[model samples]
Target chain A: MKIIRSVAEMQKETLMHKENKRSIGFAPTMGYFHKGHLQLIEEAKKENDIVAVSIFVNPLQFGENEDFGRYPRDEKRDIQLAESYGVDLLFIPTVEEMYPTKPQLNMVMVDRVDVLCGKSRPGHFDGVVTVLAKLFHIVQPNRAYFGLKDAQQIAVVDVLIQQYNFPIELIRVPTAREDNGLAMSSRNVYLTEQERAEAPAIIHALQEAKSLMENEERHPAVIVEKVRALLQQHTSAKIDYVELLSYPELKTIEQINQQVIVAVAVQFEKARLIDNIIYHP
Target chain B: MKIIRSVAEMQKETLMHKENKRSIGFAPTMGYFHKGHLQLIEEAKKENDIVAVSIFVNPLQFGENEDFGRYPRDEKRDIQLAESYGVDLLFIPTVEEMYPTKPQLNMVMVDRVDVLCGKSRPGHFDGVVTVLAKLFHIVQPNRAYFGLKDAQQIAVVDVLIQQYNFPIELIRVPTAREDNGLAMSSRNVYLTEQERAEAPAIIHALQEAKSLMENEERHPAVIVEKVRALLQQHTSAKIDYVELLSYPELKTIEQINQQVIVAVAVQFEKARLIDNIIYHP
Candidate 1:
């Protein structure tokens, strides 16, 4: 794999591929590669003539004291694995390179950022959309892969593409999970020994909620409350939020008749775990 | 020439050309085509295999009490002229078609908007960037054209292109003018007959300032003051502003040594006029 450290060269490379009529697929990450990252790369490789991956731990996306500095990195392994996965291009820009200039005066705050993980982390989706906007220009991808691991992020990306009319397709890759059903994430390394033992409970809670949803229990509040109780019972963590809202649109619904996302976040000692199940009720 | 009123079809049309390795040049306007609009279209046609023009009287770019409601249109003549000029595709989306959904919550406020015409019209450039962002996505042109008549707008477009990493060249077409040197603008239709006769004084004032700079005038304040006095002496319109700033950056300069823009705006009874000349001093 060819590793690029400059934005201009990356844009030039992508433009060359574009001129050659190659469909490029892009997967953007924050470096510490895991099974989820591999899955996204695989998805890209399956569909496009060229696959590009970006590892940018954008400071704009991290809220105050939200581990922007302490975000873990496994660069050597990541580079090797990228080659093994057949990534055509890898972009690893320094923080200074990514943000050479000071940020814009007024921020791009999203409209549907009032719920889910977005509720506690204000401006987080805005930051995500902003960086993606920049990266999309550089990569010039025909399709970009984003995991359903952070469903809110996927929804925000949808809005970004629609509102900006970015002529790029957003592919939603399914969450890569462990044997125990825990969602795969680089931040899993932040879990302490005991916290790691209890981490799988997040997915387990969501699975139970999904079962309830599948069984035709239609009260959103009741399902959310049950999920919260299950999380509290299965793990020693503070419940951040348990929400059931309309999928993609992400609005509160009085009755669960359409598609909905039942999501939950739990704050462990070191890591905050989030998981969700989207289904038609 | 094909005229696309639907955003989806326009996007597909552009994408087809993009995939076929045909370069597209784009000119975005608000209909009522004139010499300036023709100049931009001509520039686009000169360089690309495909040329696309959009006529959207973007409501977002108009401030409250602005002329959005009365923005002139000559749809039949505009369409005929577009075809006569050999435009490959012309997109004239209605307000409802262009804006199917409500706008995003938070606005994109630009920096360097506190001077010149931007000072009087707040959020004007923000609206321009917003609409342009959407249009750029749909058109997906290799190069986009804009007139240097609104120098501040060009500066804002430069920032938008840079900040968002839009992979499109901005072609700054020169301002097409009337025989007496009044800048060609659709808003000129609103000018009374006498006002039209006096409008050339704005350019005369700027020309006098340019002469001062060419003769080694270093102080922007002095040149600006002289231009304001000339405009006041020659035109019946109220002088909105006469200022000199760094080129493209649009910042106040200590002394005019590098590239700079000497810009002015005048408020007639029914129309506001803007003009500028950018050159190395």
Candidate 2:
């Protein structure tokens, strides 16, 4: 596997691949490889002539008070994991390489960011779209892989691709989960022993909400209250939010007749965990 | 020459060019072919294996009171002129084709805007960069051409390319002008015969400012005052603005020790005309 560190070099490599008519599949990620990230790479490896993975912890996506400085990174392990998955190229750009100077233009989200995690974390989606735009231009991937664990992010990417007309196919892999039904995440490392024990309740609450929706609980307000009560009764974690909205569009839905997302965020002693399930009624 | 009217078709055509290893040079313009637009096409024809021209009168760049509805367009003449220049592909997408839905994200200018024409036209640069971003992604030109007639635009494009790390190179063509020294523009058609005759004074003021700077006048205020006085005396036009600043950066400079831009705008009875000259000291 070839390890690339510079944006210019990666672009040149991708251009050569294009000239040779090779299909490139890309997986962009922050470091500290987890099962969820590996699932995305596996999907890419199966579909393309070359699979390229970028492991850059984008600083632009982190707010001033967010965990940017303490974001977990294990370069050696990540490189090994990616290589083991038969990734053809591994790009690990430094913060300086990704952003030599502050951008003079901002890519601001105009929609699909008013509920769920977006409401609690302002400017987070903007930071995400900006870095992703840069990555998409640099990689020029024929198709890019993103896990559905970040459902809102996938929705935002859909809008970006459609609006800008980027010649890329977005491939979404289903969320990878632990044996206990907790969604796999790199942030899982931040959890203490006690917090880790309580994290699975976030997913449990989502599953219960889905079951309730399946059992003819159509009102979003009722579903949200039941999910909140389940989290309160079962786990020591403080409820951040429990929201039900239209999938992808994230618009308010009065009744569950179509696809909707039931998402929850909970604050443990040392970690904030999030989980969601897309329901069709 | 092949004419593309759909964004999907244009993107596919560009993708085929990329796979074939052909270098594409792009010229983006509003319709109504002028000497300036032709000059840009001519330069593209010389350097690239394939020259592509897009004639889009982008509404995003026009203000509420501006002439967006009345923007000049002559498709038959434009197609003929582009074909004569050996343009391999001509992309003419409708506003609906370009923006099927209103953009859910906005690319906003953070700098290089607050001066010159940007001072009077708020959100104009935002609209410009937004459309350009979409065009660049769809066309995927190896190198894109822009005339330096709009100097601040070139500056904004410079930032956009650098910040996004677009793989395309930017080639700037010098401004094309009429014999009497008025910069050739599609809007030149809006001027009455008498107004057209006096419009050359905009360029004349720029030249006078250049000469003054060359003759050791370093203070921006003194040079601007002299240029304003010259325009007032030489033509029956309303002075919109006369300003001097650092080239590309568009920042105020105390002394003329480096490259600078002297730009002016004048409003006639029916048309608004602008011109500028870059000076090195």
The docking quality of candidate 2, as DockQ, is 0.87
**What TM value does model 2 have?**
0.98
How does model 1 do on interface RMSD, in angstroms? 2.1
- Give TM-scores for every candidate, taking all chains together and pairing residue i with residue i: 0.96, 0.98
TM-score of predicted chain A against the true chain A, for each candidate: 0.98, 0.98
User: What digit string (tens of lDDT, one per residue) describes model 2 on residues A1-281?
Assistant: 99999999999998888789999999999979889988888898888999999998888878787788888889998999988988998999999998898778899998998877778888888988998899988888999999888899999999988898999999989999999888898888888887777778788888888889889989999999988998998888888888899998999988998899998888776667788899899
Expressed as tens digits, the lDDT of each residue in B1-281 for candidate 1 is 99999999999999889889899999999899999999999899899999999989999989998989988989999999999999999999988887778865344755768898789888888888888888998999899999999888888887778877788999999999999999999999989999998999999988999999999999998999999898988889998888899987788998999999999989999999999888796
Lowest summed lDDT across 10 adjacent residues in model 2 chain A is found at A266-275
Give the residue spans of candidate 2 off by over 4 A: none
Interface RMSD of each: 2.1, 0.8
Stretches off by above 4 angstroms in model 1 are A105-107, B105-107
